[model samples]
Target: MSGLYRDVGVVLRTYKLRESDRIVVIHTKENGKIRAVAKGVRKTRSKFGARLEPMSHVRLLLYRGRELDIVSQAEAVEPLSPMLSSLDRASQGLAALEAVDQLSLEREPDPRAHAMLVGVLRTIAAKPSPLNVPAFYWKLLAHEGLRPQLDACVRCGDSEPSARLVAFDLVEGGVLCRSCRSGQAISEPALELLRDILGGRLQSALDREESPVTHEVAALATRALEHQIERRLRAVAMFERG
Candidate 1:
């Protein structure tokens, strides 16, 4: 193991250890997800306290070990304090972190996923808008290889004459069209807007001032993500309640 090294990372979660220490989980740009002990972080006067909070983006000096690393020093890159201060933005931020945590494996380098997550965090911190949060989530899922087929039917792979109703198969990782939805659950509006969102046409859908479709898409996307991850995220539940 290396004696010490530096990496830019986003704090995914943190837990108190002992009276004045903390265990932090961070998604780094260089080394991917890592867990490190932030000694004395729980202390009131600890310099690393603010930098160890969830959603905080920081440059950390890590002392690598066989099992876990130690966060020797940390400097804030983007505190994300503003986003964490707002209830809605905070919930969204937590949801994003939880999703990444659920999908990412330890010490695996995924630069695209890391960049997407950092971008999402920056956006949420700068602007507290739920309108684009679902879109971000959808894009992340796509990046993670769980994107559902929105342009055509997943069942028969139809390209011509789009279906009125589309049934998203969370287990199958795509959508089924009207003709293929004989015994499958289908949602027409949700499927349509999902296509739009996946195609990066969310602005067009929102320009029409239609929110129901977005809502449905959000729900479906969440369900699909949960199925892929095989576990329900607590942050998502908190987001829904908020």
Candidate 2:
């Protein structure tokens, strides 16, 4: 296991190491999430510095090290360009990366998670939407089997169609009927938007323009994801502030 291995992954983040090196965290197709050292990457002339930037998708050849892997070679597959140029898209993309980093276990092989991250970056770059980040959050939660219950009240299993679901409880993990109402107030449109995101009407939901309902859904989705992960996503705050 102390030799070279090849993989394609998106660089989730990077930090300074020694004078001319960096430590990068990436979520790979074959190896899941990994931490590796990129030597000489801080210098202006370093060949792979841009390729290893956060959100850049690259194919890598890395030498397995005892504590960390060494980047042997890197070729950019999708450079971080257009996404970084727009503040909104950049923050959303970073939030997605942060969420993946939070959920991914080091060296765990999860191809679906890798694909989801890559797809999200591509989506943010090519077709930006207010719902894109929220949709990603919901889809990721669903994949983790932590999806919020929508068909019936999570508390007391109330399924009366006449009883309107008027609230959402993050801790309880679902919508609540009028009787069980607690936590944030939720509108019918917001609930329908949540269902659309998780129930195969994703395209329509994503295509809808920015509205109060969409904003409500986005806020709910962010809170739900943060609740599950139990950490505030810094990038989310950056975008919201911008």
Candidate 3:
């Protein structure tokens, strides 16, 4: 556990370094999230150039360096090529990467986060449901202990049954009852959809006619995640732009 390491991970993103090298952002199962320099990867005949591309799942051999780890070798585990076959699938995959990249820290072990992302990517590749993206985000937040409080008034902890979610407070981190309401108005349907998302009902929750509040729920999840991680998520922004 000193100067060298090996891990199986998914490529989150890559930044070009000089002309023929790349700095790859990866979410590794054993070593958590990390960035390592893949030297000469941009060369015409480089071994790992294709394997190190974003959203690729591969096993990497790394050597510790003073500044950045160097990728000594890379072998493809699951290239995840299907997820990149269409624009929709590709967007979902990249957004998933951005979400994981923002939520996780470098060199931290997060098996739950890692598995959640890998599973979500596999699901998206198969189904490509719109709700899957937001559901993935909310689920990741729940895993990180940032799930929005939906069962009661955030201020009073009043658990009395109410249809309308009424208001949501990002700072308070949940919904506020009518009596304790100084938050953004959100509908009961939105709250229910969010609940289903957390409960792993991606397809069923989105099976009916699309509700306007569904977009609101996605926005809320993004805002909540950004609030916790304190980083603006380009995943949400870019996905919406498309």
Candidate 4:
């Protein structure tokens, strides 16, 4: 807390401060979330301005201050040009960034969540797909121990979900069996997609032929995350707009 410290971080969000300074929220691999001031960031020739953009992975050097730290130096560790070049990829990547910002705590380390953010952003940069956003949401939820129970009923513990009108209940936080049906009913196909996503079969879920149910799964995943966090996410709304 005295000298300059360095950490690998993902720029989550930034707010303009005064004329040239800015407040940046960064999620680090070792220090979780940190709100620090980046001086002279509004200047056109600022070296680290682009590096502080949301979803940019950077190795940051900081000096701890009384209330917030000051970003002394930042080197882009993972360039986000590929993801930013495409609007679709950019939206998904931003949603991942915003979701992590909203769901995480300040100064608390969650390396798994940090790694998941980096992994998902890299995936978006490498392969821009509609499923990556929801996959990131699902992975974050699971990291927070809010993983939906799709294998069996949330109430009766019935594993033969096919026999029932497969539905996911946000209130119950998982799939509901026939005997415990509570929320809106979903098709078996949609339920299967959710299962595939939660079961670590992301490639299968994404590689599967395009279908209406995939959108349904996206909506379901978004709703589930929103319900857990108890707030509508701006990134989710923005992604839905396009």
Which candidate should be chosen as best, given lDDT against the real structure?
Answer: 2
TM-score of every candidate: 0.89, 0.96, 0.90, 0.94
- Which window of ten consecutive residues has the lowest lDDT sum in model 2? 233-242
Per-residue lDDT of model 2, residues 199-232, tens digit only:
9999899899999999999989888888988888
lDDT by residue (140-199, candidate 4, tens digit) is 898899888877888888777254746778898888877788887878898878778888
| Model 4 misplaced stretches (Cα beyond 4 Å) | 161-165, 239-242
lDDT, residue 2, candidate 3: 83
The window of 10 residues in a row where model 1 has the poorest summed lDDT is 202-211
**Model 1 alpha-carbon miss at residue 232, Å:** 1.3
- Which of 2 and 4 is ahead in lDDT? 2
Q: Which stretches of candidate 1 lie over 4 Å from their true place?
A: 160-165, 182-189, 202-210, 239-242
Give lDDT tens digits, candidate 3, residues 1-242: 58888888999999999999999988999889888999899999998768998888888899888878899999988757798789889988888888888888898999889888888888878877767677888888888888788888888888656533489998998888888887688788888888787766766775645458777787787788788878788866765687
lDDT for 130 (candidate 3): 69
lDDT of each prediction vs. the true structure? 0.78, 0.90, 0.83, 0.85
- Backbone clashes in model 1: 0
Q: After superposition, which runs of candidate 3 have C-alpha atoms over 4 Å from their true positions?
A: 162-164, 200-203, 206-210, 239-242
Model 3, position 135: C-alpha lDDT score? 81
